[model samples]
Target chain A: MTEPLFDRVALIGIGLIGSSLALNIRANGLARHIAVTTRRRETLEKAEALGLGDSYHLEATEAVADADFVILCVPVGVCGAITSEIAPHLKKGAIVSDVGSVKGAVIDQMRPHLPEGVDFVPAHPLAGTEQSGPESGFLELFRNRWCILTPPEGTDPAAIEKVEAFWRGCGSNVETMTAEHHDLVLAIVSHVPHLIAYNIVGTAADLETVTQSEVVKFSASGFRDFTRIAASDPTMWRDVFLTNRDAVLEMLARFSEDLASLQRAIRWGDGDTLFDLFTRTRAIRRNVIEAGQDTAKPNFGREPGNGEAAPGESTGS
Target chain B: MTEPLFDRVALIGIGLIGSSLALNIRANGLARHIAVTTRRRETLEKAEALGLGDSYHLEATEAVADADFVILCVPVGVCGAITSEIAPHLKKGAIVSDVGSVKGAVIDQMRPHLPEGVDFVPAHPLAGTEQSGPESGFLELFRNRWCILTPPEGTDPAAIEKVEAFWRGCGSNVETMTAEHHDLVLAIVSHVPHLIAYNIVGTAADLETVTQSEVVKFSASGFRDFTRIAASDPTMWRDVFLTNRDAVLEMLARFSEDLASLQRAIRWGDGDTLFDLFTRTRAIRRNVIEAGQDTAKPNFGREPGNGEAAPGESTGS
Candidate 1:
């Protein structure tokens, strides 16, 4: 077995991503001491019951004491407040990072609160499920998944390597990207798709002609797939849209414009246009299957039997 | 075992649904003689290779000759032509039904061509996968699913009962409804969902800012689900939209209005609205599960490694 990556690692905000990281770190012996913190007392107690960390702390400041690396795993909206609350307690030369979906806002929000001696790295782990909360997490959540780190210019190379090594130890492939680029890429890929799902579900629910009962009854055809995504934790998504407003809105504008064209084609009964677009999308699914990002299992590669993936079989590649 | 439902059952256009019905009929001894017809000679040959029927015919008229029951499984656009060709050859007192998604248009198109002696029962088996073609089907596809038969007014009660009993032997729960009601219900349940999926996928593909590669890379989050539905047979979907235009348009209009409201909420950072909608959608999913319309398995109840349930799993309740 490999040596422990860090002597002590602190996780602030032990939600789905955070608890999963702790579980992975413990399962792999990646850290000697794993300290966890969450804003809610009940969540900390639940994490304690789940044995997600070596030590649990409700206070953000207490969790980071004596930590070699501190990873903030709360929602993006809370990153700044948590950083400010814990900044004074961060150990000298400690590396601070986050498991946020949006990168630019995270840096802007958390960088100022970090002490000069500590290295502040903004990282986004492109891994999650529709299920949220600590109980929904698993040890293999990040395996073969992408963990992107966006470091501001002139950051210490040693600090960057340390953060990269930590994520790698947790079974992730590390990639370095600019904060803006990360946000833009995610806006198109994750953010826009999520927004669209939420909108469609909302649309289906509000229909007077098509009762809610009917949408649920026949959802298996196509709509049910969107429901899993749409049913995601509303708080996390609200923060995502608010923080990543520019990029998300840009993608939405493009999406709306394209949707209008499709509406027009449908109205005009243009089979050729519909056929061309439908044919092109098939390649993307093939690409996802090939990348090992998705399993070939029928019905979106949802693992069978258990609600989650089998033991040691991570959803990500 | 119960007696065979018909002396001879002729299926015109043996695609996924048609082929599946043939296989189920054979497995359950629902018919003594099965006749298959397809526009393409290659499909007929392939159906023969799979032993889908006792007799395979290229001519629609030839296939229906002396048949006690004839089912048109062709696209909605071709229903009228197939009905006209097979009308003269149909045996008197035979029951004729179709597995078309849009019942109203199908009835209108085929009603003129049907002989007075033959009963026309327009049915929509409320089940299917994204896959198409004969090889893509299996015997247990309709098990525990709903087979909705929309018999026109003044139809013989015995004719309806025989059709209902045939579908039941193929592993379906039978329901009788008017052709118009079937069209409206399906417009909300299946047709509108397919259109939205196609439209969204088209939108994603046309984005200049978000390359196709990025969409594929980050698709596991939400977009991949839509791609699967969008990848369904183009001709079948085009025919569905064309035939179910009014109900689809009405449902689409409602969907669009609700989508616009959700967009406004996102723009204005209305977290309450987002949360409320997200929370409410969960109830419908639960209702679907309770109604046995959705499989209890995490991913549509098709578990990996469980070959038994996977092959013949019901697409509907």
Candidate 2:
């Protein structure tokens, strides 16, 4: 059998991404020993109960001591402080990484605190559910998803390749790009879409004309799809908008400007403009499906016997 | 077996909703005979090929003649002209209903041309996918879905109950409201959500810095969900905006206002504001799930073995 990838690997933060990573690392024997740490005793105990790691620590320094690789799986907002605390104890030649959603901000936060001889490779796994916490994770969360790595200039080629292989072992296809490019691409594809979803759900809830019950009861008509992403972890998303502000704002401006034109077309009864834009958008859905980023099944395959209420029984999505 | 609900039913459009209705009607024996009509010969032939109807015709007059029930299952924009063509041939005391999305405009379009003896009831079945045409339908499309019926005040009570029973037989929970209220409610629940989905997809496609391929690659983060509804039928959506202009504009303005505040909070780095909104929206998702409007499964159950590319394989959603 192949040897484990690392002798000792430290996973800081045992939330959804971290817990899922723990499951993958252990299930695939990606690391010889797993050291887990988190801020809360309850979360750490839960991780222990789940057997997510070989050893557990409350302090960042304790977890990082002599670890060959360290991955910060916490929200991006707190990476800098955690980096400072763990910098003194990081093993020489240790490969440091993260599962942050925003790359440029995360790199800027962690790169300054790193001690010499440690290689930092920042990555954003394009995989998640709206669900969070230790219990919400599973073994297959990262399987078949893209894990994008953005390493700083002059970083060791050997380190990047090892990290790439590590993610491959966890069941992800690895890609690399500049942090700037990753932020812009994610701003449109992930961050901006999430912002729109949160904004719209909030809007729907605040409306006095449409009761909250009404919105909830009638949500199968497209609104419920937005709620899936809108329901994501609040702390993680707050940090995302706080750190990736400029790129998100730029993409959001484009979104709002286009929405204005659609609203105008509606007001003026310009059927051609509405029809043209609507037709163009359909092609993008086809591309997303064809590229394997999504499925073609109706309603995302939420149908009868999939736990939905069948006809003459109950109302469901 | 009990007698069928009607001796004959005339359905005047062979699109997604029409074809699905035909399947349900025939499968459940809601009507003894189903007569289908559409403007396109190919669509009529496709419906026939699918065995969706007992008889098919290209002319509205031919389909409606001697029919005990007539349903205009066409787009709202052309409802008036088709209603005019079918009015002169309507059988006395026949119950006429339609499956249009917008109730007020469709009522205004069709009510004036109906002959004296026939009773008119209009309904909007709150169920569909991002697919269209005769073939893109299924028997369970209306199962566990809400179907709203908006009948003109003082219309025969017997007619309203029969249509409700027919939809109930087709596996839907039926509700009644005035035409104006139905338009407003649907504008928030269905029409506005669809517009937002279409607008965001259009905005992403038009970006110069972000390649379309990049958008497709990273779409699993959040944007792919929006693309599902954005791919819905163009002509149908165009008519929705055209006919339900006031309600959609009202909802759009409210949506834009809420988004502006969220954007301002992002620009100013108000983490509390962002966090508060994000937290509040999570509650809405729970309500939707508890109401049976959605499931709590991660990524809507699009996981490994659900046709997704699994770990150590290829990329997938």
Off by over 4 Å in 1: A301-317, B295-317
| DockQ of every predicted complex | 0.31, 0.56
Identify the runs in model 2 with alpha carbons over 4 angstroms from their true place: A305-317, B305-317
Q: How would you encode candidate 2's per-residue C-alpha lDDT over A1-317 as one tens digit per residue?
A: 58998999999999988999899899999999999999999999999999999999999799999899999999999999999999989989999999888889889989999999999999888888888889987887777788999998999999999899999998888999999999999999889888988988998998888888988888887788778788989999999999999999999999999999989999999999999988999999999888887777777766542255322211111
Error of 1 at B265 (Å): 2.2
Instruction: Tell me the fnat of candidate 1.
Output: 0.28
The candidate maximizing DockQ is 2
| Residue range A205-297, candidate 1, lDDT tens digits | 777665787666656545666666676777788788878888887877777676667667767777777677767766666676676656555
Task: Give me the overall lDDT of model 1.
Answer: 0.76
lDDT by residue for model 1 (B164-183), tens: 98988877778787878777
